[model samples]
Target: MSTALTFTTSRRPDGAVVLTATGEVDMSNAGAFATALAGARQTAADTPFVVDLTAVEYLDSAGLSVLFPHVEHLHLIANPLLAPVLTIAGLDDVTTISE
Candidate 1:
């Protein structure tokens, strides 16, 4: 069965775009997460794109792959559980991640 995932985008007063994701991020719903990320990027290409993952209960390789290409432009805010995963995946080295 597919996992539940939802994305919400909001513009900050400073003009940055924040994409808040909730629920699990696994192979089952990674495609939708990628689509949301792409859409958020398209919404404000010039501004910073913040992806909030504090509410995400889990994330796997599929979700990490989807985030790889966007590292140059992504500022990730993740919870303690996912911070290590992102770091282990080498995403933290190339991108800014706050835990």
Candidate 2:
């Protein structure tokens, strides 16, 4: 079987969701990214979720596209390379990136 793209999501006792995404999030892994993002959004409705991208090696616009308008808060795990993507997508307003 193909090694599925993976990410870890944890929900705090207070209901905050933290999703740490790793690996490549491209066409091959887009589905997993979408699924994980969707799940995080669903779980974060009450408290908000953070999408940590510190460990992510790559990300496609498709993955970012799916995340738009779906989640309440998206905290990016900061990377100089990827931070610009969010700015280009005009998501800088929607995300909190830690550099």
Candidate 3:
């Protein structure tokens, strides 16, 4: 079964956008995740776009794919459990990951 995923968007005083995700991220909810990312980008086009995955319990390839396109401008905050997955996907080399 697909796990539930929740997304919240917030803007920092400096105009940076933060997209916080909770729960698992898999193919089932990847589209929603992408949509959230797109919205966050549109909200703050020139500033930092942070994806906080600290509360996420899981993330699959589909979710990773959505993140790839935004690597140039995305900053991620993940828990230790998800760190290796992101690193193995080579996301760490492109974007900042704070665990």
Candidate 4:
């Protein structure tokens, strides 16, 4: 099922930005994700980033592509369904995601 892309931000003492993404990340909301991630990057230039995708139930290549451009230390919290896709796509090693 398609899901909403809700965004919330938290700041670390060192200045890294943590944007929590809760819900499915599919074609529909991919742009929203990109926008949100972009906003975080603009605000926290040079700071590390962590996208908690544990609550995300689905993901597509477009969604993955949006993340490739920016952000370092990409952390996928716990997304079993999306993990395999990332792995097969060779993003599993490049992008860090936990199952």
Candidate 5:
């Protein structure tokens, strides 16, 4: 079953698109996460896509997989707990990560 994962998309004053995620993100809800990212990419393909995971309680490999294809166009604002996972997955090499 899917957990309670919510995504909110907004644009920054600087024109960057940000998608904020809350709650747990696992295999069950990873597709939803991908859909949100796809929508944000469609809205502004040329601009940077920032994902804010500060409010997310948990994230699994499935959640990370959804981000792989967009790494080149993505930036991440994650909490300390998730930062290391991102780094270990080598996402930090392709995308900018902020704690």
Candidate 6:
């Protein structure tokens, strides 16, 4: 069974695409996360992709895996709870992470 997850996509005033995720992200729902990211990419191609995970309660490796390909073009906004995990995964090396 998939965990409950919510994804909302919008364009920023500066034309950046923002994908905001709330709830748990794990193996069961990683595919949904990927789909949401893909939609954001399609909507804002060539623009910055910002992922707001401030409302996320949990994120596992499966969730992180889907973000790898877009790391260079991604900007992440997360709460203190997930900041260390992102850093540990080396996502911080490729993307801009704000806590």
lDDT of 4 at 11: 78
Question: Relative to the unseen true structure, what is the Cα RMSD of model 4?
Answer: 2.6
Model 1 poorest 10 in a row by lDDT: 39-48
Q: Taking the tens digit of each residue's C-alpha lDDT, what string does model 1 give over 1-99? A: 899999999988888999999999999999999999999888978666999999999999999999998888889999999999999999989999998
lDDT of 1 at 79: 99
lDDT tens readout by residue for model 5, 50-96: 89999998989999999998988889999999899889999989999
lDDT by residue (tens digit), candidate 3, 47-94: 769999999999999999999988988899999999999999999899
Pairs in steric clash, model 2: none
What pairs collide in candidate 3? none
Regions of model 6 farther than 4 Å from truth: none
Quick one: RMSD of model 6? Answer: 0.8
**Between the candidate structures 4 and 6, which one is better when assessed by TM-score?**
6
Query: Which lDDT value does model 3 have at 90?
Result: 98
- Listed per candidate, the RMSD to the true structure in angstroms reads 0.8, 2.5, 1.3, 2.6, 0.8, 0.8
How far residue 89's Cα lies from its native spot in candidate 1, in Å, is 0.4
For model 6 the local lDDT of residue 72 reads 75
Local error of candidate 4 at residue 39 (angstroms): 1.1
Candidate 6: deviation at residue 56, Å? 0.6
List the lowest-lDDT window of 10 residues for candidate 6. 39-48
lDDT agreement with native, every candidate = 0.94, 0.73, 0.91, 0.75, 0.91, 0.92
